[model samples]
Target: MCLGDISARSQDQMILNLQGCDIPIHESQDFKDFSEIGTGGYASVYTAHWKITKTKLAIKQFFESSTKEIKEIIINEIHLMEIMRKKVIFHPNIIKFYGITKLKDEINYAMILEYADGGTLGKYLRDNAESFKWENQLKFANDIASAILWLHDNDIIHRDLHPNNILIHQHSIKLADFGCNASSIQLEILKGTREMPVSATNRIFVNLYKECWEHEPEERPDIDQVILRLNSIPKSHFDSKENEESEIIDELDLSDCDVQLYY
Candidate 1:
């Protein structure tokens, strides 16, 4: 996946459906007239409407390239979403998926998602940078923590949980993107009257990032654990050298959002 190969790969994504797969394709009726909302390292976001449902949706269209392993990743993502659709289960601060596209070998993959009105937390922070203080930061962290905890409690690891991954809608906080979801972290289970400790399983994520990016995936922090860490840091947290604004923003702490599993 050299830079030059991107163009050719992106063309496949322009396909509305994969033929012969009997995949249900919902091409944006106004595809040619939709608004480009944003772009990511590998995808483009658009605001589109579903004619049958007459509902608004956010479309994340990925660029084409055989190098990215997420094709299977996206396929698995859809399956995981289908299974975990209710995992969030009545939580007001999480985003919901509407549907998914069929898999393909020669085209860009797309996922239909529930659109957020307030935009990414990063963008909002920048826009209101001067006004964001400990009050807003703490509130945002609490809301996001609740959503993340819900995901972890359900046994799903959202490998990417940075500020950019957060979608805010008025008062609600929605966590988006699950391309790197890992296995569930079940509670210590009872097996034949014997108890086993998977404490390392809980620490798997930390292994992914204990030292700078210790990135020892095996040691990454789970949601329940993250809740404890976030709570331990006081709401008035501030590093004198970092400045008041920087300190507050710094404390919301997406510093360890990116984690990898260790061997």
Candidate 2:
């Protein structure tokens, strides 16, 4: 169904909920200076300037070919964003969702998101591999861990997690691309029965990575434990001015924290 042609009741409810969550609905004219940045199976991403806020933003526009499927995906993502907004789970490492826009004479709505100047984390690592120090690598790991912790705590699983899905902006991590493939069963079973392989040589985070990649999900460490281990990395590995400055992990008290999984 076209976003603009939804049933009156559904449209009204959506508009009311969006207003309650402070998510603005705008027209295509609200943005300018569009440049196609990326393309995916269902949508094309563009860098545009939001005329209202004067901010550089990424606009994800779904294609019209698969209208029904694409519409559901868009609604699901927006609903997840609404939940994040309501629960106040806005973390520095998570990509920010601003609002949505309907293009002129178009059937689909576009998502307005934070623009990442540094591009995907995969590209960033490849470009700076030689110059990237352990301190910097640990920082990225901690950032990803923190975001994953928050996401898991809030019952959201980024099913399509990968280096490309994890973006980098201004030298920081921004978790992105929460697609519509939510597993019906909470338990995600790995295909193989073999134990997760670890590197031969000893490295500071090798064990941590191994624990996280355990064959059984139950055998893996929780995000909180992963974060605690990550926090120890900088303190245990290096004692330089740069490491001290690059350390971004905060003292988080998780004693009373509760993890709730929404089905």
Candidate 3:
């Protein structure tokens, strides 16, 4: 992300062509020709620029053989986004979806969202860990909590909430990738202990689906409760090292998940 020498040189280029761009999205298109920003079991994210607005956007492309199900999910997500986007909202920790590419095919589907320049929080933490102050970390934790609360207020559960999905922009936060987002009532996890501990040190992916992977769906905490847990995340509760690029690699290997760390 260091544009230093390049800032001196003239590298007028990027993954997606901004001067002229196009989309013929279908349920079948493979969404090729670009570096994948992120790849999960069902989808991959790409870096894109909106020609109309000339703004940076993160395009998450989902591949599905089931045409009906794909379209249904796409439509539902679009509707949910439309409702949530009605208000002008901004946060330092949550990703925001702009709009969606007009659905053309069943296999080709993508969501357009604001670009998270600093990349994933994991990457940011690593890049600045050497000198980042405690105040910055505290602000981040608080910002994320607020965003989760906002989503809950709207009756949506970011079932896949985690650090890698979170983005930072000039110290602001934006949560990204809502492919797994859903609207559902929540219960609780009898952790034997009083409540589920909101731990930031936990690796991102491992924590996002904490309750979903659990045998009992009832044990999953609802969005509101999730908000409380996030809000309760006291910065002073724990101390952490300045995240390093090395740590990012180690954690990814431990999680055994293939994902891009955009530090």
Top lDDT: which candidate number?
Answer: 2
* Full candidate order by TM-score, most accurate first: 2, 1, 3
Candidate 2's clash total is 0
Model 1 misplacement above 4 A: 1-27, 30-33, 52-54, 66-68, 86-90, 101-109, 181-222, 225-243, 246-263
Clashes of 1: 27
Q: Name the runs in model 2 displaced over 4 angstroms.
A: 1-23, 67-70, 181-189, 193-202, 234-263
- Against the true structure, candidate 3 reaches a TM-score of 0.55
Q: Please identify model 3 stretches exceeding 4 Å from their true place.
A: 1-35, 66-76, 88-93, 102-107, 181-258, 261-263
lDDT, candidate 1, 1-263, per-residue tens: 01112233353333333343332345444333356776655567777776666667787766664234555455555555555654446467767676554233526556777878878777676566566655566568778888867766677777766666787787567877776643232222112221222231223223322422323445556556666665666443522232556544444433333321100
For model 2, residues 1-263, the per-residue Cα lDDT tens digits are 12232334432122213433455677789899998877776778889997877899998877766445555666777767656655654889988887688766666667888998888766665556446565677789899999998999889987766666778898899988776653333353455433333322125576777777778789999989989878876554644343332232112122211211100
C-alpha local distance difference test of each model? 0.55, 0.66, 0.52
By TM-score, who's the top model here? 2
Error of 1 at 112 (Å): 0.9
**Position 231, candidate 3: lDDT:** 54
TM-score to true structure, per model: 0.59, 0.74, 0.55
User: Cα deviation in Å at residue 135, candidate 2?
Assistant: 0.7
Task: Give the Cα error of residue 109 in candidate 1, in Å.
Answer: 4.4
Model 3 lDDT tens row, 73-192:
544555555556665764435556554453344334467666777877766655664565655655776677678778776677666655566778878777765545432223332343
lDDT score, candidate 3, position 10: 23
